[model samples]
Target: MRLVVAITGASGAIYGVRILQMLSALGVESHLVTSRHAMLTLTTETDWTPEGLRSLATHVHPVGDVGSVIASGSFQHDGMIIAPCSVKTLSGVANCYADNLVTRAADVTLKEGRRLVLVFRETPLHLGHLRLLTQAAEMGATVFPPVPAFYHEPKVIDDLVDQTAGRVLDQFGLDAAVARWEGMRPLRERQDQQPDHQAALGEPVNG
Candidate 1:
């Protein structure tokens, strides 16, 4: 499957990086576009270089290249994802502002009636943020915030990143090795066994 991926100026640059990594592993064709601020954020937040991040995708387009193939609606692809989508980018998409390649591609995606996923990374949003998000959703965009799930028992930062990336791929019907929740039965059983094991070890158990 072919997809257009955009990395914007958001704090969690790793989300976009991991999405590219997973897409590459799945042998998916990815067209990547990274904003200038996104590159800086990547450098500040992670060790990945701009060159390394671009290498993961099948094609890389400049953020200002509005004439790129993915910017047009005729350039058919499965979908588009703006990982770590900044509020600025979100506003552009919501307002149908095609000033750049990222927003242009997103507009084309919506116009083509294809999936448009926006991984909005901001938190503690105000009313304006919510309104913009609601507007985008009303325009057939999926506003997916990278909220980490603890039920999967993430052991490290990478685990959390991978889980969120995998879930994002899931939106496209692509499955990754993310842990799925079966039910509460297993967790309850494990919790019950935990106390016994602690008692056997003569460890102090909290009531």
Candidate 2:
């Protein structure tokens, strides 16, 4: 387990932070690279400082350091993940534009045939967004949007974040304690367990 992780200028900076924390807990080697705007998002969206975020990774590379080890295909690693991947970064990856370290590493990941997971954080996408995502997928990148699931019944924001991060790790075959979706209960069983909505609301239940 060695992985390259990039945090781009997306709203959910916490996704990248959670992934780093989990990777550290799992004793995985993580090479982190954060964009300038990602640092701003980290501070704006969460209390985590750039220094704190750097401490979670085994190594931290500057966003412009295209000559870094992870930028080359020969730097054998398990995979790369661009958590909270911005559409700008997505475009770069889709177009094989290696202007920055994040895109460069992603390019190398695809060229090396290693797993490249993009935790895209945009919503209400237009045709161009879809096209870019499709192109990246065709190039072997996993475009994973951080869509929250309620099957585990999240009680807090952190739970939702953890679930998304865990699911991302799942793509790399790492277990982050994500709630697996088992077969649903039988319809009759579910109905039997359902509470009386009218009674709960203090309304008289019809016979």
Candidate 3:
């Protein structure tokens, strides 16, 4: 499956990186595009240089190069994911403003009735942010936020990122083994393995 992955200027650059890593491991063809501001985030948030990030994908498209293959609807792909999608990029997609390759590809994805998942990374949203998100959802885009799942009992930050990435991939029907939530346990089952169960499930055992 070919997947277009876009990393915007969001706070959590790791989401995009983890998505690329999982895609590569799953043998999926990843076409990556990083915004100019995304590059800045990479330097500030991660050790990855632009080239290092590019190396993770099967194809890398420049943000300004709107003539790229993914920019057109004819370019067949399974889906597109804008990991760590910034509010600016989210607005562009919400409004169908294809001023750059990222938004153009996203617009094409929506027009073609393909899955377009936007993993928006923002906090303390105002009314404008909520409206834009609703607009994007109304246009058949999945507005996914990279919220951490505490139920997964993550031991490290990578675990949280992986769980979020895995869940996001679930929207595309791709299983990355990142779902950390186990089902609710029966009374006997819970009591039989209370300590181990709590540790494994990231839940607190009461008495």
Candidate 4:
């Protein structure tokens, strides 16, 4: 499978790294791009060197390359992901602002009726943010906020990261990580186990 992965100037650059690792593991080829701000964020938030980013994708295009193949709807890809997608990139995609290849790729993904998953990372959204997200949703872009799941009983940061990446991959019909959403014992098992778990945290267990 082929996918386009864009990293923007969001706080969590680690998600981008993890997504690349997961995609590589699944043998999915990635066309990767990162904004100037995203590159800067990597320096500040991660130890990702230039070589590390290059190693993640089959082809790495500059963010300014609007004429790149992935930017056109004619280029067929299984899906696209903007891991740790910033609000700026989200707004650019939502408003049809295809000034750069990343946004253009996003626009193309929506127009082509392919999966476009945006891992929007901004928090405490105002109406403007909500509006842009709604617009993107209306255009068939999947607006996935990077929220953790308690149901998974996550014990580490990697667990949460993998679960979210797995969900994103599922949008493309690709299983990149553990199937966190399937193969449950039953709803009764969850309900039966929740009381003890919640009680340990001194919280009310509502089944």
What TM-score does prediction 3 earn?
A: 0.89
Q: Give the local distance difference test score of model 2.
A: 0.94
Best by lDDT: 2
User: What is the per-residue lDDT of model 1 for residues 1-207, given as tens digits with 9 covering 90 to 100?
Assistant: 999999999999999999999998999999999987999999999999999999999999999888899988889899999999999999999999989999999999999999999999898999999999999999999989999988777789999999999999999999878877766667677786454766788887664
* Model 2: how far residue 149 lies from native, Å: 0.9
* Residue range 1-207, candidate 4, lDDT tens digits: 899999999988888888888889988899999988988888888889867877988889998888899988888888899999999999999999988988999999998898899999998999999999999999999999989875678878888888888887888888774636555678888777664867788887674
Descending-TM-score candidate ranking: 1, 2, 3, 4
Output the better candidate (2/3) by TM-score: 2
lDDT of 2 at 70: 89
Residue 4 lDDT (model 1): 94
- Candidate 3 per-residue lDDT, tens place, 105-144, comes to 9999999999999999999999999999999999999989
lDDT of 2 by residue, 1-207 (tens): 899999999999999999999999999999999987999999999999999999999999999888889888889999999999999999999999999999999999999999999999898999999999999999999989999998776789999999999999999899987777787889898778778898999999884
| Model 3 misplaced regions, further than 4 Å | 186-207
In model 1, what lDDT does residue 77 have?
99
lDDT of 1: 0.93
Candidate 2, clashing residue pairs?
none
TM-scores of the candidates are: 0.92, 0.92, 0.89, 0.86
